[model samples]
Target chain A: MVNTRNMVADNYTPESVAEAVRKYDGVRRKQAIGSLVRSLHIDNIDVVASYGEDAAVIQNGRTALLLAADGIWNKLMEVDPYWAGYCAILVNVHDIAAMGGRPVAMVDVLSASDDAIMTEVSRGMHDAAVAFDVPVVGGHLHPDAPYNVIDVSILGVAELENIIYSSKAQPNDAIIAAIDLKGRIHPSAPMNWDSVTMKTSDVLRSQISVMKDLGERHLLTAGKDISNPGVIGTLGMLIESSGVGAVVDLTAIPRPDLDALGITFEQWVRMYPGMGFIMTANRSDVETVCKKFRKTGMAAQVIGTVTSTKKFTLVKGEQETVLFNFCEEGITNI
Target chain B: MVNTRNMVADNYTPESVAEAVRKYDGVRRKQAIGSLVRSLHIDNIDVVASYGEDAAVIQNGRTALLLAADGIWNKLMEVDPYWAGYCAILVNVHDIAAMGGRPVAMVDVLSASDDAIMTEVSRGMHDAAVAFDVPVVGGHLHPDAPYNVIDVSILGVAELENIIYSSKAQPNDAIIAAIDLKGRIHPSAPMNWDSVTMKTSDVLRSQISVMKDLGERHLLTAGKDISNPGVIGTLGMLIESSGVGAVVDLTAIPRPDLDALGITFEQWVRMYPGMGFIMTANRSDVETVCKKFRKTGMAAQVIGTVTSTKKFTLVKGEQETVLFNFCEEGITNI
Candidate 1:
């Protein structure tokens, strides 16, 4: 690994990184999920788990059904309707993949202010669906709504015994971050790292299936797709859900050539990667999990370790800082 | 049966009824679905049926997975956030029920301008989920969006042999309309018939199961829930999807006391029912199907016959008028 400690600008400190991540819009938006979950929560025998995972798990006989929904932010739609539509599918597919399930199909509810935006959004969805090899089966469309929005929901399936969960991390587990780093920042959204768009359909599908393989082999204890919250923020969510804490080595986290990309390490940690995941595995299985991800052209490394202290701490050589203390605050309180 | 011809206002005629339904906002909104389908359509080996069906069917082993999504209109959300949220679940449940599948769970994407709207919407969704016995497993919540919107998607399951489809109607099939008429018009929306709000969970579940029972008994040729397009418009959609036409006898259509409800026959025909369905069955099975629905406390009757003339017509005693000529115009055009 490159000496990222020396390459960091004088202003970039462990404390500054922690403070910047804590106040980010992407991370702050998640604060409302806790209260919303309390209002919508209801008991059902078939529901295996909900709220905290990437996708909710439902028991269907011997097979497990994964269900999830996501909506595109209005700002994304305004800046680039095409990319907005494309990411709607991209994020949903990751939800199921993060659960170690095979995404079977998707349905969408789309409303547009006009036909021009509608056509462009549909084209983006069509292209992404084709690239991922998942069909947009059916949906409702509001052709004349005063606002433009695209919300997509996906259904995926996996064996009941092979599903990964975000709420199963254990103390002493190795925390790993895997990211596809062979791409540039998205032109439309600087916080987005676009990697999947340049890859072939086969390559994209193969990369997604690695999570399923790792789950089947029983390598990872807990995992989640790196979403809008970026690497550290997303990891905070996972550990929060799992009722644990972690100490991350800032220098050990995988990254592209940040200096070459003309971005600081702070911005790099918060970018929503087009293809990435944060996972925890037993120390014995960490090597196997990293190797599986590396075989797919992704950067994978052990970045941290699960702790019982209930504090999310960051370290870089001698410098150290606490990003979040779950006992006091939460990323997604649910 | 009520002799409603004398109760009609002077302006209510076959021509007037047809013209009123043709220009309704609900029906007109559907016209855009045809072209939107063209843009989003992608072929997959596993999709059993889509586009024209209430719920898209996907093949998986010996079972069929039904997936569908619906969004509440902005006007409804603006008027009553609670009813809007409740209807979001109601419509999704009807989508799966119309397909003769058991709805397993649902996911939602909700965006609200403030906390009050979000709380009300979530409460509405919670109540509906409990009443329907389907769990709201997980969803995305946008607590600070500039607008309020709720989009819900459902996942249902059925044995492959018992799955019903909308594209299977045939010439000479008997057309039947079944509606629960034991309620009043909703105060929040005049065009909505509120049959379900007062019913118990057992009664509502029993009513929904009639379609599944009919499917298992192989009693219907094709069926669809009466949605925003109302009775005649929904029938036109089914027939259009099946590549056939139908002649509906307006007088034979079931209705509540129009004079007591203070609604004209034309307005009553276009009102969205809380629980209603229009279906086509073989002539030999018409009596059995109608009896099944009536036993569940719904109004059922043979209202018309499917035809191959490619023209949707309305007949009232001696007077007749063509409503939609499929050769030139279409309701949904799909």
Candidate 2:
């Protein structure tokens, strides 16, 4: 009796997990984003960075203005309008923070056919706005509509010299991921890992400020928040955007107890963690950056190392599998 | 015999026309906007101005960051997705320009049920982005949806000291309206005045730059773009926001052959002009400001004067009618 449950259960190879994540809908949907970006790209005088970054950086004198927008998924809107609305703001704030900026304000565009749905959405938006301390300024509202939709855009600010970008990762940098793993999967949505809602406002705010600190200190080379795509997929995106590659160790990826949560390793690697980020930093600064995130009550660990091969790979025990080959296939191709 | 036809049919009794415009659906729909604003207002660290203005302003160091989001009407989306997408970007750009800011970049959230609508909408967005030289960066896309909707948000930058706000008009200030009347009604939507698509990019760019000039010179006290609620309703919103009032001489409003367009005097005030702005300026600077707009190929005229009575009145030959009273009833109450 050689601890059969532990060995057999955790013995799943990396190739199987890699293939599933590569073919996941969350990752596949991103394939068309690049073409759409190319079609709409134009020369703008004030736009310092656009399609390739988390938020488009606009040069406004000595300050860099961050602008980004996110929409709630239709399925989420149908199941629960409140969560959808909360996530709309949640994702946008993450976008700004991922770029090492402080979110200042937000505007929303909401369309709803039902009054009950509208009220719930508003309630969620209000709760999130208050928690984040970012005002919901002005927006267009469609009161009577056949479908429900919520789109939110945020504006943030950072010093021009201190702003971090997604295209500056260097080879041999340590890849670190900081995630708040103190929450469980949402009862309504299996893929959603609820973390922020249950925490105090101070805790959430502290977690958001860690990125800004890293930006100011120039501790991180490149970064992105974990979104609909899970941890591994998000790292793939960061690597692709930086025109570099990464090799992530499966065991080092921070995760809650999958067995207790009734989820598998593969599913855990493909689910969106509500409050999580993937970042790259120099080996010398890794300890300082991770310590900053740890102070905010998040688990930070070195999950991988940036590489020059232009390919994303996953390793589990002695098995290794390629998730994406940027030379031929890209995540967003931004 | 009464010379009704020769006496300028467009210059009808202001009382009757005012009543018709007050009851129009375009204006009536705006009545709900105020309640929504009151519900959403929150305290933020950097938000300087929000609801009731064309764009929300946020303090970003020495600069003011402008953020705004707009959604196309459901009817317009059903009529033509292409025009709907085009208008989405067009209106957001106007929101920034109306605030005397330089537009930086935009992001859009598109919900479509099929590829045909998506293609058309994307094409329209592409055309406008290229024409205006504003890039549509990254945004959310709903590939399979129950309905079609397009919402766009923009980022802009303005000098903190020179930003034009909608709530600063003083009593006795001249109210000026500048509009491009050289356009036809859109074939898909009769209420839309399609001036931008017909003009060359050079002409539109110059027209947009006029607002910047006005801000830099401190020529205007308050300003806003004429949107779906049309010229008068937009003016009503501005006055309500400023907590002031105005009296308009209906005969002074610029119109392009109401007879040729087969529209009534009331209908003209409710039609959405493609390129138009309402500004409140000191009586002394009115002439110079109007001259600047006229040089940019726009028709500019003094149509009213700001008042302290907190009422918007439309006046004609020996007849007058009240449009809105900010003290008792508000348009957007922001």
Candidate 3:
């Protein structure tokens, strides 16, 4: 059991935690992004942000157009193509939702080694798309590939003034961890937290729309959808993009019943929860933002304080450990 | 060598030619799309066109937003990741161009087994993106995959009134085949014709712009950028979408000296030329449309005529071959 009050949480050392997170496949896979980003330059004046955000924003008159692409992990596809297909839609929709945008449609490119498995993937994608109310308008399919892969790209639109940016975190803002705790670990993939599959379309739509509502009311200074890197690593990306840091109180981070779930706190932190977001809110708006998230049944708490210093530290009891030294290294390096 | 003015073109029977094209890997690979399309419901009223077109067009106020995705062949990626990378961008850009829209940005999802080859692929994508003037805005990377795969998606914008649709070919429209003949077969992959990599950006831009120009002028009734299905197969898709048929004179189709290239006429028809388009224009506009393409250094010809029958046929001398009986089986089944 995790020691509820101690900062170290258990006998885990700061170095061990840091190494575990750093060496995680989710975090390490991001290392290749920095180089590809440097090579793919943004020359279009309409492009407001790219590479560092969950979705790229393009200026279109008074509206902002959002675009993003995501691919399934090969192992995940092999283990469960149905889940792979569903996540392809889920992740892309969240990319837009993280930007406080209205996801409209998606296009997918699926490469498969066989037909039956591809059908399973397609079925999962279809069910997700309908649940999210976003159309998979069109895409490409490579039927006879040696390996199976599913990639999806999404399009969204948002009011220019209401678009939430990941690079706008301020020094005095409070970092909030908002997660839906009413789900079990995916039976097939322990790393995945399953919450959306069992939820009604109405509930899921309302949950995703809360971000837009927050953006409209200017409740958060910065925000990002929690992805494969989990809450801590995702926060590192946000802070790196914002050029700031945070000292998180470990006990304040939200979680389900870990004992019942049969997962350690470290393992839970690394899971890709079905519905989660990390956000930084102005000190005056932290209570209101947390209240809004709580309205949607999400466990929201002010878990940390943003700082001017470029080091991310986790504090538990009297002991403190630095998770990322942005001045020296970064999760994505971009 | 192919004998000119022969009824059978190369002593090949019409049935054999039809079977060869129908069974081509490029055309057969698209077989999985119809079922996927049926599963993905397009309920959004803004979706103007989806499964059948090169790009999905969504209505956005006075403008149209175009979205499209394409993945490279797996064997090609393994043989040459660099060309695979370039073609990823090339094909996505062409998707927008085929819709008569100006491509604004791109997002890619690249899965690789190693860093060195990924770096090479990234370099190739970067070079092609820079040459095409479309920035790679944002995307995902799967670094440690068992195989290499590159998927790219494009976002484009066009005037709502001027958007050219693939399903608009008139009964008597002339089918125009515009291809750049100044380049040789790709050394890395014989199936691909290398034209864009060797041409200057000015020429490539001009060639791509011709479709938009034709759209604005209302010269083309329908259009599609030639893709993996090759010229004849691609034209079949256009005609099928329009619910019409075409009789193409094989001898009049544009070519790049197949004898010198040491390829048969059938192989030439199946090659995926880098810079080519199949468009349907009014009989009176054919001269102007062909002239416009010629100005961009492309070989343009009116080698076919659209008909009301739901069958795509090929003609050589006095012999005629039914390439596709679309009434019975359409290419994409969309």
By TM-score, who's the top model here?
1
The local distance difference test score of each candidate is 0.91, 0.86, 0.88
Place model 1 in a CAPRI quality band. Answer: high
For every prediction, compared with the true complex, DockQ reads 0.86, 0.65, 0.81
TM-score of chain A of each: 0.97, 0.97, 0.96
For candidate 1, give the lDDT of residue A151.
98
lDDT of 1: 0.91
- Which residue pairs in candidate 2 have backbone atoms (N, alpha carbon, C) closer than 3 angstroms, thus clashing? none
User: Over the stretch B290-323, how does candidate 3's per-residue lDDT look in tens digits?
Assistant: 9999999999999889999998988878878898
Off by over 4 Å in 1: A1-11, B1-11
lDDT of 2 by residue, B1-334 (tens): 6555674455577777777777877777666666667666787667788887789888766778888999999899999988988899889889999999988788988888887888888888988877777788767777667788899998888998888898898899999999999898889998898888888888888898899899999999999999988888888888888888899999899888777777777777788898999999998999999999899889999999999999999998688888887778776554
Each candidate structure's TM-score, on Cα atoms with residue i matched to residue i, is: 0.97, 0.94, 0.97
lDDT of 3 by residue, A1-334 (tens): 6565453334454455666777788877887788778877758889999889999999988889899999988878988999999999999999999999999899999998898888999999999999999999988999888988999999999998998999999998999999999988987788999988989998889888889999888888999999999888888889989999998887688988776576767777778988999999988998898888788888999999999999999876677889889899887888
Candidates sorted by lDDT, best first: 1, 3, 2
Native contacts present in candidate 2, fraction? 0.67
Model 3 chain A scores worst on lDDT over the 10 consecutive residues at A5-14
Q: In DockQ, how does model 1 score against the reference complex?
A: 0.86
> Which residue pairs show backbone clashes in model 3?
A7-A316
Compare candidates 1 and 2 on lDDT and give the better one.
Answer: 1
> Which docking class does model 3 fall in?
high
Worst 10 residues of 2 chain B by lDDT: B2-11
